[model samples]
Target chain A: MKLRDFVLRRIILAIPVIFGVLTITWFLSYVVGDPLAMYVTERTPDAAIPGIIRARGLDAPLVVQYFLYLTALFQGDWGVSTTTGADQPVLTVLARLFPATIELSIVAMSIAIVLGIPLGIISATRKDKAADHVTRVFALIGVSMPIFWFGLMLKYVLFYQLSVWDLPHLPGGDRYNFRAFGSWQPTTGFLLIDSLLFEHNPALFLDAVVHLIMPAFCLGYITLAIITRMMRSSMLEVIKEDYITLAKSKGLSERVVIYKHALRNALIPTVTVIGLAFGGLITGAVLTETIFNWPGLGRWATNSILNSDIAAINGFTLLVAFIFVIANFIVDMIYGVLDPRIRFG
Target chain B: MSDELVLHVKDLYVNFYTYEGIVKALDGVEMFLRRGDTMGVVGETGCGKSVTAKSILRLIEAPGRLDDGQILFFDQDFETKETIELDLAKLELEEMLEIRGNRISIVFQDPATYPNPVFRIGDQIAEVIELHQNLAMDVLYMKIAKLELTLSEATSDENRAEIEGKISYYRQQLDDPPEPDKKSMREAAKLKAIEMLRLVRMPAPEQVVNQYPHELSGGMRQRALIAMSLACNPSILICDEATTALDVTVQAQVLLLLNQLKAEIGTSIIVITHDMGVVAETCNWVNVMYAGTTVESCATEEIFAKPLHPYTAGLLIAVPKLHEVKDRLPQIRGTVPNLITPPTGCRFHPRCDYATSVCKEKKPLLEELEPGHWVACHHPLRS
Candidate 1:
């Protein structure tokens, strides 16, 4: 029942999950005919094809190739991208792009959490009032709107029309001011932090923040809506509990009864949603990144998939799967903190 | 000691507005308690016992309003050196907060629901202590700031060290307070909470204080709840079905504890329960309720000895006795009437076997038949 042992057990359980994800991605990407299909074309150099296939280890048996993939994966060799033809390792490419998605997801999740929980509490406390109705309408619109369309509309409004109306041209689509920081000076990988700390450019940091707002809002709106609705309903249910009555009977302030007593228990479900949503944000970054021209893993993965870049696709799936498992593990730990009933064995 | 009135409720009415109808939960219910006396509000389910208790505290939230009532709480006003009557129903929230946990406290039905599960028992008890306990120099920082400003404005260098020393003393008390002083106020509060636990006979109060509510058994939880409620040394403690959720053995133990507490702390108690046995054993006075109205009020022995109200007689007969021989236990006919459209006249007329034309046409008010006994009935039992 110890917390450390519980955590260790969860980590052990995640191994099989990671392996399953990697195996599925490997079989789907590698087993389908040629790994070098994207590199091949109807050219006159037919004799060089066998040499290229042998060079890429496509000549090995299926089982041997699986073991080789696992070994190379353990050794941090994620194979090479076939689309660029520059022999760039998938690991290095993904490493370069992953932080942009992480930064975006962090900002987006922060916005969701900051706005969602209090709004939900307000909606619950003022149930059936004007405040509740307004929040419900806002949540409905936020949930129903398509993210892609929402992103484009945001760009059109804030970046285009708003800029024309005498505002500074808001940064959009790009990660940072590429002109100022020309070389990809890898520091912390997170552009916001790297721009400030590594690049030593406050302008770049401010510019990155400006560019981040629109896409972050577009991505975060759905999570905010879902969290708000969840919190409202959960708070409503928890507030009706006898514990809440007992809390008020103790003459504790209404704030303490609602937040300290009801909200802590209500938030158990919200934590689960937040964790799952964070993982979804990572995968969902593909569409957001494409619209915003963010050079993150999602955009890279989409490009790789279109080009049949097998190695890049495999690495991306495994990485996302690992992050998902870790997020769920963290949520479980938070549940233990929130409710004393859920003791781990 | 018993003659000193602690709480007096007159014509208290509580109504719950629901989609179905407005439930007149407590319709003109009246009761009074004296110092160190335990008064039991005995009634069947849906008889407004809990409602009456909640109304006294003005804890009836939205959709359920304290429609009309006067809860006159008598307490000593320290500054005035006289007992003051507080109309709890009219008191604003700020004033209510001062009286709620300090002068009056409550022990709820289910012990499991009383303590917040996330916090340790020590923290829960300590919170109440910290809320009620006001230490001298507790109005910290602002006074210190004003003193610092005065020290700064002073042009003389001669008295600078003395002023500086005074500032440092206040600062030390603000930061790491010394023992037996304003600085160690929180520690003192925690110690008081633990002392309360010890008073409730919680074994190894030191270890139990650190554990969460889930770590304790049902009996322990109830004991902890009692401990938490008594931490402020409240003048009146309301036990709203305090022992109903526990097993029989634990129930007896808890009742014994409450009796011991009443003797030791001299706190008047309002025991709201449906259990007649609990009333017979623990209560000094019994008030029988039916459909949100008190049908009978008398001393426990007097009510049992010469039951005047037909409803009270029915309740006494319904209780299964060990010495009596019967194939099947006697039970009262029919269920509790719908309070929203409650029976006209006497609410119990429909279920009363001795219901007369007078009983059906007119409601009998609670009237004193003897010196210490009161009953609401048209057909009074003659001895």
Candidate 2:
């Protein structure tokens, strides 16, 4: 099959997957609680309650409501959030928050790949040695440690305790300080890039990076742990393949045999884990965002749920599902590239 | 160089430490190879034929240790007129790099899995050629510089004559026609790899060189592997069941290729396999192994004509004759003994029809029953 057909087929297949996610989320969001309860108060007039229900389309039948929701969704109408009381569109809210989450995820994933893969390679090649044991233990601790606690502990050490040493206090719980940075004019919505591009200040970029460091680390800890452990086991498995022995028998150095011959084949499965982990990272950011006060989508989604802002919750679910499906599609393309057998098939 | 012993493996002992027990993979295995000879080490599965071949280059990994062995490699170059004896086991990995593939190379079984899938054919073949050939030239260059230094200081005619002779010898080692430029060495190696591919009978050598291993057919891949092995003109070529994975026609083609190489390249060959037919077709001398030990060793024709060991007799009988009519072809009874806890005395006794009390009690050493034939059995067959 041609590469063009393969890509096209994958994209067409994603439509149903996205539709299924939206249907499930729509049902679950309504089942949790009635969205009308937020607007209804003890002193409210009984006549005003029906008017609010009709205005929000809450009085419509379940099927009618779902179709209305789908129609509005296709027109890019994410509906309004009742949590802030100002009634802001969920799309506008996402625009304000997603950049922060994206920025955090990028930092975290970069750290995961840069540190995790080589460390994993080292662990596998060293096998049962002290280096392997040390990496395994570190990954174990990283996995078991709760993100909230890890985030708070980092805040305590890097943000609070270092004040006495005259080190620049690390920022946590927010994207950037509005007072010091002068209200960040939206450019890319990514603060670090925007601070330099629109604000045109090097010091602001540095401040943005420092503010990002703690939350990104806490957010990325689990992903790093998972990738490291996955890569080590994968590398160990590929190293035992007959091709590796063949490489060594050819009198190639141990370096070439391990990295070139073993690592490339091993990376096929590792890439899948990485793609899934990226999708998970976007959703898993809730606790880290809460602790660090990072104004990201997770924090907004949590606020939406507490206020019974059904439309905002539904919209968030659709976005998350779309991200995951797209990530997986990209992973499949990479798999074909990595293994020729898959490419031809 | 043609008449000299190129490889001599003496009293080689390899043990694999497993949870069950110490698996005696190779028990005092001994074999020697003269230059230009094609020797076959034939055995049934699990009999340590492949292990012996790997032991020569110290390619055996952990869990398996070379407990006691001396792989004496006699390194002699006719062009350079240099001679050295290297006990391979005693050499460090760095030192072994100099000899591995450069002086001794291997072609493994299952060529499908042997060449790295990610690498281009040319790059893989060129790698060995560059490492061995480039390093050889570097060493030669160093020697030439030292010879020039010695010649400058020498006042006596005797000393000058000696220095000049040594200088010319080292210079000749670089190139036959004295293309002494070091820069062209890498290009020379690449050209040599292309030539080697053509020699292996690979069609469209230029196209195949750029293609990945996965693009090639099984026989073509095996032929490419053969080309890589012969790249450095290794004096000792170990083919560890090289033709086992090939089809019958490809097997014939490969075996024929090896025979042609033996006459053309003049490299001593160690062909390890379980196939009796391969031994009959390609080998001048044969070593029949039974459970980590050399049970019988003789000239290939003699072993077939008048088999001495009962085990050898059984193996010969197991091979079906083309014209012979029978309900069932003869088979050697009993399975291969578990190496973790092998049968104590004369491992073949359990299956041997001629087993005696003495055969069950004593383990026999290889005895030279005839002038050139050796057998490790208590009760020998009469010619």
* Residue B87, model 2, lDDT: 98
Query: Tens digit of lDDT per residue, candidate 2, span B71-157?
Result: 999988668968789999899988887777878889999988888776679878887887777445644665677679888999999
Give DockQ per model, in order. Answer: 0.57, 0.38
Candidate 2 chain A has its poorest 10 consecutive residues by lDDT at: A336-345
Best by TM-score: 1
Query: Per-residue lDDT for B113-230 in model 1, tens only?
Result: 7778888898788878877776434434444666788898888886777778887887878765433454356655666677889999999999988899999999999999898889
Candidate 1 is scored at a TM of 0.92
Cα lDDT of model 2 by residue, A308-332, tens digit:
8888888888888888998898889
Residue pairs clashing in model 2 are A173-A292, A173-A293
Query: On residues A142-170, what C-alpha lDDT tens digit does candidate 1 reach at each position?
Result: 89999999999988988888778978767
Among all candidates shown, the one with the greatest DockQ:
1
Model 2 ranges off by over 4 Å: A35-44, A58-64, A160-172, A177-179, B135-195, B343-363, B377-379
What is the lDDT, from 0 to 100, of the residue B323 in candidate 1? 94
TM-score of predicted chain B, candidate 1 = 0.86
Candidate 1 has an interface RMSD (Å) of 1.4
